[model samples]
Target: MKNTILRFNDAVYRLCIAVAGLSMLTMALIIPWGIFARYVLGSGSSWPEPVAILLMVVFTFFGAAASYRAGAHMAVNMATDRMPPALRQGAAILVQILMAVVCLFMAVKGWKLCANTWNQFLGEMPGLRVGVSYLPIPVGGVLTLLFVLEKLFLGDQSHRRVVRFDLVEESEGAA
Candidate 1:
């Protein structure tokens, strides 16, 4: 059961990472084209700016969730690190609970925002619904919530190293 859950978590993490990476890549490509078209071509394309903004939204939210799972998100651990083991554990639990509450709030409010704006269309991209862009809010929230639950029930999987290297083996192979 534990292995199954961990596997699922790993899959989700990888998926989020992939989505974030693709969003960034698309934004990078689109922005330069937008600039070139505006200056060099003497006319700016309407699609690039809005598309880049949408991609950025996707990148930020999904990237954040992935970062949280990998324990790479910004945190001030100065106080917690100084505490004794028992106190540290207690503090960790408290923080996780608080985080869970925040995620819940995000999920609820995000969904409402998404639903309410479903009828609205983007000015630049009329085919795209404004509400579609807001989807990452609730999706990211749910992902964070799942990660918190995994930590609270199963244990911290963040410390598990995804990569390792052997210098000796590499040197021997070179020789």
Candidate 2:
């Protein structure tokens, strides 16, 4: 049962990522076509640039959520480093829960904002005409929540120890 849920979660997450990626790819192709036409053929595109920006916004938010799901977000844990291993893990879990709550709040707020402007359109840029700048918020929020829940399921919160190695040419110190 647990494995099934994990598989479903991963599938859903990947779908979101694919959607975001397709949007970006389309935007890139469209914008370049617009630019090339305007420059070479001397015909201006009706709305390529604005469309690109809108897609960019979507890409950023969705990408962020994807990153969170993959555990790609960064944080410093030096403060917890000195604590005993057991205590350190507990502290990390606490921090994760707190972060999850904050993210959930943002998601709710963002979804509300998106809902509030359902019939509205962006002024001055019709091609950029998305009523919701709030899409990314929910995406990020949900992803963060998923990550937190996954962490709970795993029941491990040990902070990874990173070893930075300095590679330098070996010079004799005359020992």
Candidate 3:
């Protein structure tokens, strides 16, 4: 059951990444096309503005997921690192649990926020409707929270060792 959950989470994370990348690509193209149409073709696209906003929303969520996976999110590890090994471990656990709680809150809040804007934000866009753009926030929160929980427990071999990823990162990039 646990393995199944992790695999599902991994699949979801990959899908989120793909969707975000597509959003970024689409946004990039739309912006350039709109600019080119205005300057060279002497006309502007009405579709690009709404599309760009949607794509940007998707981009933010996916970017956050990627950052979470990469451990690029900010951390105040100074005090944790200074403690003894046992205390450090405890501190890490405490901090991770706090993060999970915060992520859960984010997921719930984001869903409410998106629900409030539903359909109303669905303006003209090149891709999915504007309201759908907000979908990524809750989706990303779930993915991030799951991934973090997995790391804290299972330690995904494909990603990084949970307790000592900084050393892994340092070594992996070392000359």
Q: Which prediction has the highest TM-score against the true structure?
A: 1
Q: Compute the lDDT of residue 156 as modeled in candidate 3.
A: 37
lDDT of 2 by residue, 1-175 (tens): 7645555566656766797899889997998898898999899876777777777878877777666666676767788998999999889788878978888897898888878876677764653324465577777688768767776776432242212222111222332
lDDT of 1 by residue, 18-40 (tens): 99999999999999999999999
Better of 1 and 2 by TM-score: 1
Question: TM-score per candidate, in order?
Answer: 0.90, 0.74, 0.75
Worst 10 residues of 2 by lDDT: 160-169
Model 3 off-target regions past 4 Å?
1-3, 122-130, 156-175
Please give the distance, in angstroms, between residue 173's alpha carbon in candidate 2 and its true position after superposition.
65
Q: Across residues 1-175, which tens digit of lDDT does each residue of candidate 3 receive?
A: 7655654655666676688789889998899998998899998878788778867987887777766766676778888879999998888788778878877887998898778877564546534544467777787778778767876886533454233345545876994
Show model 2 residue runs off by greater than 4 Å.
Answer: 124-130, 155-175
Q: Mind sharing the TM-score for model 3? A: 0.75
For all candidates in order, the CA lDDT equals 0.89, 0.70, 0.73
Clashes of each: 0, 0, 0
Judged by lDDT relative to the true structure, which candidate is superior, 1 or 3? 1
Clashing pairs in 2: none
Tell me how candidate 2 scores on lDDT. 0.70
Q: For candidate 2, what is the TM-score?
A: 0.74
Instruction: Tell me the alpha-carbon RMSD of every candidate.
Output: 5.7, 11.5, 7.5
